[model samples]
Target: MRSANPARHVSLPFPRAPRYGPEDQAAVRDLLHAGRLSDTSRGPAIAALEDAFADLTNTVYALSFASGTASLHGALRGVGAHPDAGVVTSPLTWISAILVAFHAGSFPVFADVEPGGVNLNPATIATAGQASAVLVTHTFGIPARMDALTAVTGVPIVEDCSHAHGARYASRPVGSWGAAGCFSLMERKPVSGGEGGVLTTNSRTVYERALTLGHHPHRLAAELTDPALRPLTSTGLGYKTRMPTVAAAIASVQLRRLADRMAASETNFARLLDVLHAHAAPITTPLVAAGSTRGWYGTPLIITEPVPNPAALFAACTAAGVPVRPLYEDWLSSPLLQDPALLHEAFPHVRHTGWRPPDPHALPNYQVARRQTLLLKVPDVPAADYMHQVGDTLATVLTQAIR
Candidate 1:
């Protein structure tokens, strides 16, 4: 008894259905029975999740944290990003990536994104100047080019894998390429811990340093073997950043289902792309780079030809129940990085270290890409029939919008 109208007939779940299976419920239930409600440090559940995640990402070590920001903070400090040091990254990313640098009391720097893409341009890294650390964000689940980046900067790299869970680059996982890879387990991320984070690394020193920065003594005692860090183990550097036992319990379950979810998500996005190619034009498909796989934090459709009315196109799509929208409507990020007066006035670190901002036109590629792109929120569940309706709705709306 569905309505013939595409808008009324369409039934796609935005924000996704609660992704927990019975296994997830069981994880929490078992933890409660064991009386481990929340551990001040990485508990048995947290440690187990960390080990499993490290294995999944092909890394030697994984450390858990209370949130994604904490994990990034730990990583920056772990790799020696101090007040005198500088951390450089592209401006076209979540503000947390830049905020972490300031959190560590380090000067933040920016490099332009690649031409017509979200990832950083390797050639421009030199122009950004010598930074003590490089932090990379895999924007919208598309892996940053690690090989190109590695060739340019000798400084350590920390990846913010907030969007990318199963996404790979050059046949290698995104987290495995850097000195430390930070993943957010916040409810919306591919790996939902409800609220938690993980930092994966290969270096023993980095692991212990990151562990000591946020974890309590109990964890540090067992995990820290380095002589330099042993003295701090009494209080473990005094920050309680352990993943909640409950979150760990949830994440462990989500980790097991990640591959399956990604595969199903891929199928759903592919079907929509098929519809777009055949029935929609001017509203073009995403230009995925060669060899780079999308984690699909978002599925962006770039407008190939200028539409008569951009607002009309977005409104029509929404009216048809497609829920298409724009991103970075104001693409300029880090106003402080541009205005030296504000930059120096805001942070003492900037004044102490003479780090100048890049030219306004430094990020021309990201500028164009951000404006042209329209984001589609894909269904997290495998609702195949519903996907077809959603795709058809967009196709019909787009065709009408151009007319």
Candidate 2:
């Protein structure tokens, strides 16, 4: 039997983001007043942040970039991806993933994701055959089966850590597992700045190439260098993708408090997941596998039972103040999918592939993705009781729809 909304007129929003502390504001102001807004003055802070981040993840090198897509471009360039050596990534990801591969002169071969909404399925990728590298995103903070993926395919792995910063699988950090790990410090990410990204790896050669692609000029940071990179300083050609010092400063402060923020969000995510799971007959709430510590980007809920109208479901969530919507509804139908002119600048490989398989995992690919799944934003961080109200409210609303 489906339960109804017992509480009348009570509104609940998920979690809200944590506010930046005075120290962060002061740091940003100092950079502003000093007139060293670019990478020159803030380079040191960004370097420090990179070092701190590397240490946190137990990796050897970390590089800061303008955005996650920029980092992706650098990662691909660093690993030597060519036009023929296509990049294999998940179709159920942000278009930025495919765009990055295109920007780096590689074709993006979209694969299907795993059942639990984690990483791209390795089997599907293996069946596709002969790709230069596999770019795996730890979707929704859940770590992909990195070990299984890497073990099966001997190709290099570039991990998209945009949503999984500080997340771990089997006690090993996500970034450390890949050849090059990329993270987003965008406004909505766990480590929010106005905009920025970071890349990490242990290989000196890969690090050198990434630095060159990211516009470091090779000699910018003496303290952070591999002896082998000394000669490349003169010949280095740089792209203007370095993160601004101001954004770097903000990310630095956020990095310091990341552990606490992750803990708080995890608590909220767990409680909400439990409540949703109790009423899982209608909605398949986000699942975290054993030995995985997730960095909840957005709490995803899959509607198992078909809804009469996805548009109506979205309206109901919005009407209830839940602010829920379908995940990337138009990703496949947008300009990139239809009108190639709209995405020509960002993605040159927009030519249609016709009826080729999108995912190797045998996962179903629907024409209108809007009807398949629903995604709800997890308040950047919400009050404890308010979090409960959100779960209760969603359970109530969904219960009504199912009935």
Highest-scoring model, TM-score: 1
How far in Å is the alpha carbon of 79 misplaced in model 2? 1.4
Q: What is the lDDT of candidate 2?
A: 0.71
Query: What TM-score would each prediction reach against the true structure?
Result: 0.88, 0.86
- Tell me the spans in candidate 1 whose CA falls farther than 4 Å from its real position: 1-16, 283-292, 307-316, 325-348, 355-361, 396-403
TM-score of 1: 0.88
Cα deviation at 373, candidate 1, in Å, is 1.2
In candidate 1, which residue pairs get closer than 3 Å at backbone N, Cα or C atoms, i.e. clash?
none
Across residues 197-290, which tens digit of lDDT does each residue of candidate 2 receive? 8889997777777776657554445433667556656545566788888878888888887787788877776676676666564666445667
Error of 2 at 184 (Å): 0.7
Superposed Cα deviation of residue 261, candidate 2 (Å):
1.7
lDDT at residue 114 of model 1 (Cα atoms): 75
lDDT of each: 0.78, 0.71
Clashing pairs for predicted structure model 2, backbone only? 15-379, 15-380, 15-381, 15-382, 16-380, 16-381, 16-382, 112-359
